[model samples]
Target: MVWGRKKKRGGRKEPVFGGVAASLAELRLNPLDRITVADDKPASRAAPRKAAGPGGDGSRERKPSQNRKGRKGRARKRTRGRLSRLFYWGAVLALWGGIAIVGVVVYVGAHLPPIQSLEIPKRPPTIKIVGADGSVLATRGEMAGSNVSLKDLPPYLPKAFIAIEDRRFYSHYGVDPIGILRAAVTNVLHMGVSQGGSTLTQQLAKNLFLTQERTLERKLQEVELALWLERKHTKAQILELYLNRVYFGSGAYGVEAAAQKYFGKPAKDVTLAEAAMLAGLVKSPSRLAPNRNPEGAEARAKVVLAAMADAHFITEQQARAATTRPSYAVKPVGAGTINYVADWVGEVLDDLVGQVDQNIVVETTIDPKLQSVAEAALIDELAAKSVKFNVSQGALVAMTPDGAIRAMVGGRNYGDSQFNRAVMAKRQPGSAFKPFVYLTAIEAGLTPETIRQDAPLDIKGWRPENYGHEYFGAVTLTQALAMSLNTVAVRLGLEVGPVNVVRTAHRLGITSKLEPNASIALGTSEVSPLELVGAYAPFANGGYAANPHIVDRIRTVDGNKLLYARAQAAPGRVIDPRSVAMMNTMMEQTLISGTARKAGIPGWTAAGKTGTSQDFRDAWFVGYTAKLVTGVWLGNDDNSPTRKATGGGLPVEVWTRFMRTAHEGMQPEPIPGTQRGGPLPDIAQLGRQVIAPAPAAPASVGGPPQPVRANVRPEAASGLDGWLVDRLFGGR
Candidate 1:
């Protein structure tokens, strides 16, 4: 019975093995039973187990044992199935977590603030210095127009800008989503962030209201503001603001300023080529300042023109024409104190309009042509003698007798330094002061024909010497003045009183303080060049002194009358008209036959005086034509004596050169109240003449011609001759 039972289990186990083999075969797997059998070790173990099983029937016993082994294999397979399911679910969770992280990163990036927006003020453009004929000279302030509506902007302008700067402006909603995605992809591929994807609105926002900080927070703020602006304002308004607020270098702060600065024209008048050039400046202002880098600016303009053609804003031919258009012409700004005349005008304005920041156009009396001539003359003279005298500085001032300063040069080169010697410097007038002394003497009853001795004179222990240290015994007052004889001037000053001379100088507009001593007769008093010119103008204007002035009128930019420059009341007569006439006559002699004769020009009446200060520190020539009065002062800044500089050397040379050019094409007029007459004729024909027929009467030899006293002279006659000689040749 046991054997039969064992056989039954064996049969069942065999079928089980056979079934497993068949399943393995269907699964195309290597069979474990075959493998174990081929290894032979498993076969031997199986044989032992089968032998011990079921009443020593090995096959029957092995059947039960195989069943147990199969069960264990099935249990192990079920456990592995659970682990596989767990692994699959874990992998799905990890993938979703990664996706969440990426989403967070993208969200943060999109929200970051923009890095570069700053707002600047909007101001109206300033008009530059245009010649009376409409040529520009210099420009001031930025120019800008009111913001235009979106529909008002030319479509081509915005379209061209977009083609170059930002193409996705309208569709991006202030932040470019695709641009961000592309940047992200690029960063991933290259392992670095290397691109900026700012949309137009973002760029506008940055320009309007942000700093250039490369921070995420600022970027987000920029995006928010850009969106806000796009929704609130039209596209044209944004563009207008951008154009007006952009910097174009050359001290220009807007499109209009840039246009005027570079092209010497207004923004509304700019050509397409000029517009492109201005637009190109948006990228680099200093590098392309119209005055600094004109070549680079032109090349950049061509690039902009090419871009315009590519965007179809213009045809290729149009682009070529625009690029070929001549660069806008501009005049260089005057170097230093370009508005020097304007500054003097400002001083007059202070009395008219008070201190205010209003735009004012002052019509001045300055003749630009004369001004140029005067400047050139002074510069040329200084340059020519720079090595000889080591004199590198000088000043020239020309004015109408009515005190209108027509032309002035404050220094040799205004570009080098700006110390206005013509107006601000105060130095000894030297012999220029003698005119006041002579005027005083004339007021005290002296005349040009009066005799004065040009001998050494003692004035309260102040011994005045002639310039050449040699004295003439006797000379006319006019001759003494023409010679600038120091001794004669001291004697005349003592006779007239130094106080009276100072007072007379003040009356004539000398205004500067004078020394109270007799030395003042030799021009020891310090006076400014302007004061000296103004003072001498009385001689030119026939004894009346007109206050020096620059501004004629001031008006607002809108043609509103701000201030009218009516002539101020004249100062009282400083000297008698006759004294002024006589003084002018003597000065005319100075130009014709005196120390300042070099200043004489043909057919022009110029009366001036030469002055060399003590130690040769300052040299001066104060003179005037019938129309103009000019003063020149040459000296060292440190008061060191010039080596060979004198009033007659370069000062008179400059004066003559300047006057020749300044008065060119202008008719010469005689000074008012001047007497026109030649010198007195010789007196040889005054006495009666005897007939030749009277020779027959010589035989008579009647009365020995009244016993003509041999070697016997009348006391009265000798005393009279001596007195006349002393008065004519010893008083000076």
Candidate 2:
């Protein structure tokens, strides 16, 4: 029946579908509609009798078929997530490891040690110069050098310095490790490389034993040296060494020299403000020099003051006051009394003592007042004669007759140069040496009244002439000396023997070599002005010759005696006391009535000699009062002759001016034995017994029968014999 219904359904399906379609005109229907058919094989499922209730509910109760696949997917997803996490962490770690390695390399390179150079001594403090009042005058140290022990420094000064330059100086063992670390960190943070973390000891090490190279090697060397220094010295000692070795500008090395240079005062006397200024100069001296840049110096000083305030070394009020204080005005260095005299003394020391370092302070015999007056007078005189002569160089020396050099001038402008003309330059003395010749003749029993022919005399091949070619015939010895007659002098030198004159000059302190010829009397021998003054000093010092000396004694800064002047007994008489006295009297006459008359100082018994060399190349006026001997030399440094310069010109003026001022506070004392019988008569005739035949009567015969020839003349007179005859008999 179902098969028939099925067959009929197949036919009827179209009709049902048409009906459904017609009914479904309001509702559309799908084309494959199924009608339920009785199952023919329904009974075949009863074999297992397994009931499927709710279809897949049983499958849900159990593991589903796709559950294993789902579990596998979940496990794979978890595994994948875990693998991704591992990869991400690996990349991060790689990047971090690279960054750490870079940092380590950079740090090691930055802190590496550097190389070393230079060998500096770690010496004790040096002795220095001090004034009479115990004020520092100069120093002896390294360059701009000197030294001072830690114990020598004032406690407060070191404290102040430490507080400002290095606050942790006492705590550190030569170097501050913490400070170094902090500096490193800060430098790295800011990428700035300017800051330094060196301790005081490190700085000293750099200054003393290491180069100032800005490298890690140098820094490491500095650290080693600093540690060694700390082990060797106490902190106080280190600080003192630092203070002394540190540069304080203006060529000053130590605190004492700096104090003298900047404040014109001693280190002990330095004011708070002055000290701050000097301390400030250490950072950059040239840029902060008060002389070159006052504003910058003042600013730096303020910074130092601020530091002092911060350190509690001074109060803020004090710092402000110091900052506002006017800049200290320093006098130019080397501007002291006796600039010329000091230079001359230095030269003399070169011979008497030895070569000295520039740091040496040579105490001289220069009288400040006397030197001032001499310089002023010379300048005024030269200015007055500026039209006639352009005299720029002048020198003067004054000394006690016993060879105590009292005053000196090497040149008019001491600041311009330091060639000491007084002790170094050898200039012709002109007529000044004539007195030595006269003295020689006097010592040989000749007096001031001795007679000599002043005619045209031919001495060997040398013809002597007067200054103006005018001869004063038959003049007395006093007249010849007073008039400075060249012919008379030549004749007298020949009479006394040139060797004797030279020897006599030596006795009077003339150390220069003298020409053993007729020119000796004419000043052909070159002599230093100081030597001339020393030579003439014996005449004023009662015939006693003394070696000229500038230094009286030498001592260390701590008052330790280094050397003392050898005690010398009064010099043995070089000339007869009577002869010296007579020479002194003659010189007095020369000063009063001779070429040096212009040098006459009223109310003072003075003696001097004027000299003008050939062509006026060297002019000299050497003189002496009862207490002082002075010599003035005027000429060009090149030895060129000045236009109108002469011994009686500017030289006399200089001598007179200095003497006038030198004797201002002193009373005039009479020369010893000057008033006693004046000078003795000439005995030249007693010794001179002419043997030649009375000059053949000169054709004018009958000259009082001509005194009988005392001695006979030799027959074969020739060469030396003829020359001797000619010289002794005043041959033309």
Candidate 3:
């Protein structure tokens, strides 16, 4: 219409170019433009196109070709819509999966301890047992050897563990992906879980923080902690921690302790063969220990050596040579007896320092040389006679006059029984307890010269008899004690009132309970060898109270703080000097002419008591010199009687054996209250030499008993018996 100048009729038609009042909208750039010339506005909605049919009826109609095209177009649109729906759901699933993954990560992280608070727990603190001269006797608590740094170990040692435990330990992160994959493949092929994929770091994480639980969650946590360890510590540090804290077996922990326990050497000194053996122990510590299963241990070590060779840590030739070398558990010297001392120290540890939170060093009073000597004496003597005597166990303890334990042999073989007989087993002292009774009597106005009947006597149906069942009609107090006449001891206990005897025993350091009765004088009451020896200490140390003690001082490993120390208080005087002199003078006769004659020391003045418990169930000898006190006991642990084994037999023999060696380097100190105290005279030099017999004396003797001394001048004696003792016996 515009082309036709629809307009010719448009009344004046808006002038050709729309002059004065015309709008710019009337302009059209092209024929397809919808701008109108008359109204100058955009057109309204278009009406549907209609096909003309049969004389302008304005009805719509379709052609066959158009219908076919429309059908194909609808099919194409349907296909495009299907593809869009597929893509939209796929994206939704992917987003949900991502969210799930984030949730799992957050959930696992929540189970962990705070990262800032993460810490490797301190291992059970090791208590080092040191001898008096500063040599390590043993470590009491956790390890035999002290802690050692990785740098101190031989390079091959750590490499051996690495070769067998984790081949790629140094190359990978804590959780090894390649190792895990290999293990997975292996497990799949076997159709079961046959191998573990834990790296050394992972194992450390499990040991330090996690329970030994097998679960999906725990494994994930382990992996996370391992990764943290890898980030926080160097590879070497992680390896060191793993090595030092891992258990090897046989009551040992740490490589250093393992080395000392199994090889009797330090980790730094272990050979290649030993290193391989130790490394193999990690796989099956209890089952593959060299001590328990040497064959298994050696076979595993061979595998480890082969692995080392394959890893280039060692040559094939070297590995083969190592296989030829023997690497087995070595038993430490005195393992049996020395452990008794260690156990005693362990019991005292808590008392000394509340709780052992850190490593500590305990300086004990044990003398290594003396300890060895004492053990040998007890063990060897028992070995020679136990079968013949029908005895199964024995114990011995040696101490200074001040009650410092120098040596302790708790049993014949600690491996067979860890029972500490020396400090724990309580048995009748028998006649050995008569000394306390006699000491009490001497304090109650009796003397070595005071006479008492040794005949059988009865007190409330309790009849006491002598060793041979033969009683002397009348014997001096010294004679009765030296002879260990049971009747005389009972009579004295009753005369002095058994309560006083009990008091004397307790005051002298007998910790065991005592029955204040007639039988108490015969040592019917039970007492430990430790207390017996400790009680005897007063007699040896000039009547001072001596409480038995083994520990000298306890301090931290670094020796900075003192946790416990033996107080240096002056000893309490438990007995007056007169009573001590009489007691010493009387008991010394037992070593010279009484029950313990065989237990004599050649160069020193010695005194002791021999005891044979009821039915010979227990035999004991508690002996002392001026400086040392030692006690020995032998019996069956079940309290069975022996084959007539008396205290004077095996116990005396063992005591003599130990005392002879103990006195070799010691200066001879005379018995107390002796004016001419010095080196004892050699008895062999005076064999059968005739001396004037002692003159029979008064029925009732008076005055202080003669002092037992060496090299006494005959004229210096106040009586004939004293002079004869000086000349013939050289002062007991």
Candidate 4:
């Protein structure tokens, strides 16, 4: 069909198509050329019959020796036009690198914080005290034992934390990309970051909404909140909200408080070698805490039991019998000073249910085996006699004669002083405050066998010496309060009126203020061993007034909701079942034969009062036992002075080794009203000394006994009818 005719011949003009006159090599050849009719010699001299070749039989004719293979076939078409412009700019830089990675995941998810109001953050409340027989003694806050479920644990403990934290955790969608290219080729062959592509749903989306700060916009808001917690939870509810919420060191926090703090059990009784040492404390939970690096938590629980036998979820003989028997966790029974009853239940937990937000359950009358025998009787008697009684510290409380505390240690190492020294150390309860100056002289009539003059004494000039300033002359106010005499407790605290011995020590529960000054009848007033064991629990519960409490109720850790309970106050009679049987027969003769016969409690007819203050500094004993009154104090948080240590020595040998382990199996009771004993047969006759009618110059419409000036001796201004006419007509 080629008929090109614009023929100029030699002037180089012979090509014409439909008007045919072609000759410039027949219009540069092949349009599938078979136009053999080119005999137009005169018109355009037909000489182009040899262009069609490949066997169309016009056979290879025109050849100026094939012009070097036509310049090497145009140099292979300019190398295929530079490989099609390098695949069109490599597909426009891979579509702008996938739109700059979706504009860096929408500018790190628009700086996060609003995935439909991302919830999951609550968790810090936890109170849980429990111990009046319901066990779990202490746990205050920051989660130590609750929220458990991934189907209540033990499917090899969340498959041993997804075989060392997410073996493609149920085939990842919460950002795994082949586990971040196998943890970036295993941290570039262990050059550093020792491997952690963060996929337990991106560590529960950076512990429930980011702050561990590594950055890159917190790893792109932890992969967009781990793909919005994998589209709002389910791979077993995000592996049970990432095994309850990860962190497992001592301050615990989930997986049932690190399986009840590393296997004191729960999480369905954890075993497989304590679930590979609590899934090897999810890597660095306080540096692999099996109670602080038990050999780096048994070498990270043998690398989580070889990643739970390489994720077959255990069995290379159960990961070599789970690292050949690895179960570590044992520290909970009164975990040292029961955190001093968890720091007095977090300082009375905002005054008994005022602000403690959520989780509660307090219930406390603490007898966790008498709080581990009052913290091993005050840390084994201050570690065997605290530098031989220079006594660094000590405290004990035990209660229940109506006060109900039942064991508190408070020091001698509540981890070297949480300073509760039995409810914050007021000290100087020396001469353990002569039982409220013999219970205000047996309610002002006087009877622990009357007789007083332990000879030498002084009032305004201060010579109250007795610990060997030697005097027992006519002693019988129960041997002058069993030889703690101090001038017969400054003459019965000046005949029952140092403001009636500070109102019988604040109606028998000494709420710490008591300084009615006859040197507070020798206790020199500084109270607190919980108000001297609730003012000696009314001489062991018979005339009641012990209000020393320690959370006896506070409810809601699912016991529905009570908030508080201890209000059953039947403790009315502050002292008078005959002055609580004559002050428990004069402090049971100072624990039978005075100065607390080393705080005796063999079969429990206990009665205490040792004390020792001023210059021998503070030391106390304060016993009780018509079912526990216990007090115990000791010395030195800089109130110094202890080497002569006495409250009859080491607080009566730590109240006779904590009332002989709190009267083991309890059944000896009698010191309450001692069956009409020691008080009225002229004060129970034992070495009879009834001289006490010495008082009376006390009455004045407001002005009298304030005139004592003798420095260290005699101030006997006899007025009660001249001391009952010299003790019933001179028998003295």
Largest TM-score belongs to which candidate? Answer: 3
**Candidates sorted by TM-score, best first:** 3, 2, 1, 4
Can you write out model 3's per-residue Cα lDDT over 32-113, one digit (the tens) per residue?
3345453312222332245433455334555768766866776687789999999999999999999998887778879999
Please give the distance, in angstroms, between residue 395's alpha carbon in candidate 2 and its true position after superposition: 2.0
Ranked by lDDT, the better of candidates 1 and 3 is 3
Per-residue lDDT over 485-552 for candidate 4, one digit per residue giving the tens place of the 0 to 100 score: 67667777776679888887888777777767667888777878887788778777888677888887
**Model 1: how far is 603 from its true place, Å?**
2.5
Q: Which tens-of-lDDT digit does each residue in 397-501 have in candidate 1?
A: 888998887876777666566677888788898888888899888888878877655554444455667665554545567777876777677778877788898
Q: TM-score for each prediction?
A: 0.61, 0.62, 0.72, 0.34
Q: What TM-score does model 2 achieve against the real structure?
A: 0.62
TM-score, structure 3 vs. true: 0.72
Order candidates by lDDT, high to low. 3, 4, 1, 2
How far out, in Å, is residue 28 in model 3?
76
RMSD of each: 18.1, 18.7, 16.5, 23.2
lDDT of 2 by residue, 1-732 (tens): 455533444353333545653464435322223254543242233222222233632211334565567557766877999999999999999999999877765564355343133344544333243332334433433334346565655544565566556778889999998878877988988899644678889988877766667876677667767877888888877887888877766557778767766776656666677777777777777677776666777777777778888878889998787667754876544533355554344345556445443333434444555656766776677668744764667777778777776666677665567677877889889989998899988988888777776656544456656665544455677767765778778777877888998998887888888988868888999999888999888877788877886655544444554433535676887877789777877777676556676777678888878888898787788888789888888878887767857777778887888788788778887665476754533323222322332221211111111122223333342222434322321201
User: Worst lDDT window (10 residues) for model 2?
Assistant: 697-706
Measured with C-alpha atoms, the lDDT of residue 331 in candidate 4 is: 58
